[model samples]
Target: MKATREAYGEALLDLGRLSDQVVALDADLSKSTKTSLFAKEFPERFFDVGIAEQNMIGIAAGLSLAGFVPFASTFAIFASGRAWEQIRNTVAYPSLNVKVCASHAGITVGEDGASHQSVEDIGLMSIIPNMTVLVPSDPIETKSIINWAFKYKGPVYVRLGRMGVPDLLPKDYSFDTKPYIFKKGKKIVIFATGIMLWKCLEAIELLKAYDIEPTLVNIPCLKPFPEKEIIEIVREHDMVFTAEEHSIIGGLGSMVASTLSRSYPMKVSFIGINDKFGTSGKPNDLLSFYGLDAAGIRDKLLDNIK
Candidate 1:
């Protein structure tokens, strides 16, 4: 198991070696966000902007204007909630090639509590017109998405987490705009993002005892949502569920619901934090407390099915 943030760090280093134009900026969180690896390897290319997320974004914008691909790092809450305006106006507005790779997203931020956790980052980034939002499930996908973000020339928000997740994708896995189908089943279909995809997979095992098999899909790209692909996938299933380690309000659940409501108009049960703030607790314990664990997800699915 490995934290996606670790993959981001490793990928950032690879990017530095692959491209000299690649630069990094952080709001005093290089060690946690794993940008330290990049900083260590390419100190000259990295700029630590202290604890000022807004200023860091501004510098990233300036770097972009100067023809550099700057990847700004910080906690998701600060990156999305604190420096939102700077990101919106400075980076996203001009369609600059700035990568805002915020780590420690969702309730999984753990013992740090709600103040640090960012359940609304996806929505915050998604609402922006020129921003692209991504949530990678595991380390492999995280690396793939990071590589993809470096190549894609625009404002990109890649939400990463501190919790270590199991390796789900293969070593040769590549990032595609379409959602990944982890399992094939009938009737019920589940769409999950980030670490929640791993939880959903666990929930599927519990469902097997009841002879309930649901198709599972991993949605890594939140913005530029795979509408065409989702429409095609939903047509094959009867029931739909969207799970995320975020608020049910503006994350994967909301996006899937909106898409289906307009295109196919189907019901999508949401499995996520019900607009509540996180509290200090062990990461795994917090997941269970919020009914985001395998058993909780299974029960929720069964409740809807019954």
Candidate 2:
């Protein structure tokens, strides 16, 4: 198992070696955000803004204007909260080649409590007009997404977690801006994002005991949501469910619901943290407490099915 943050750090190092124009900026959380790896390998190309997320974002925007691809790293809460205006006005509005790679996102930022946990980061980032939001499921996908972000011109937000998660994608798996079907079924469909995809896979195993066969989809791209594919998949299933380690309000659930509401609306259920703040605890325990774990997800689906 490997944390997505670790993959991001390694990807940044690879990107640095591939292109000198690739620069990294951090808000004094290099060690935690894992951008320190890039700083170590390419000290001249890295800038530590010293606890100033807003300034870091502005600097990244400037770098982008100067024809450089800048990657800014920070905690999800600070990147999407503290520097929102800078991100909106400086980077996103201009549609600059700036990548905001935020780590320790969602309720999985355990022990740090609500202040550090960013359940609404995806919502905040996705709301921007020119921003492309991405939440990779595992280490391999995280690397692939980072590579994609570098090649794609414009503003992008990549959400990553602190906890180590099991690898769900194959070693040679490449990422696209579309959703990927992990398991195919007919009774119901579950669209999950981030590490929740892993949980949904486990839930599927338990669901089989109850004679429920559900399709599972991994939504890595939250913004520019795979509308056509989602509509097609929803058409194949009787019911739909969206699971994420985020608030059900404006994360994957809300996006999927909005897409389906316009095209193929059905019995859509959400499995996520319902309008609440997280507390200090083990990551897995918090997931279980919020009914986002495998067993909890299975029970929730079964209840709705019956």
Model 1, runs deviating above 4 Å: none
TM-score of 1: 0.99
Candidate 1 residue lDDT tens string, 1-306: 999999999999999999999999999999999999999999999999898999999999999999999999999999999999999999888899999999999999999999999999999999999999999999999999999999999999999999999899888999986899989999999999999999999999999999999999999999999988998999999999999999999899998999998979989999999999888999999999999999999999999999
Candidate 1: the clashing residue pairs are none
**What's the CA error at residue 247 for candidate 2, in Å?**
0.7
lDDT of each: 0.95, 0.93
The prediction achieving the highest lDDT against the true structure is 1
For model 2, the run of ten residues with the poorest summed lDDT: 259-268
Over 1-306, each residue of candidate 2 has an lDDT whose tens digit, in order, gives 989999999999999999999999999999988999999999999999898999999999999899999999999999999999999998888798999999999988999999999999999999999999999999999999999999998999999999998889999989998889989987699999999999999999988888888999999999988999999888888889999999999999999989888887766899998999989999999999999999999999988988
Error of 1 at 68 (Å): 0.6
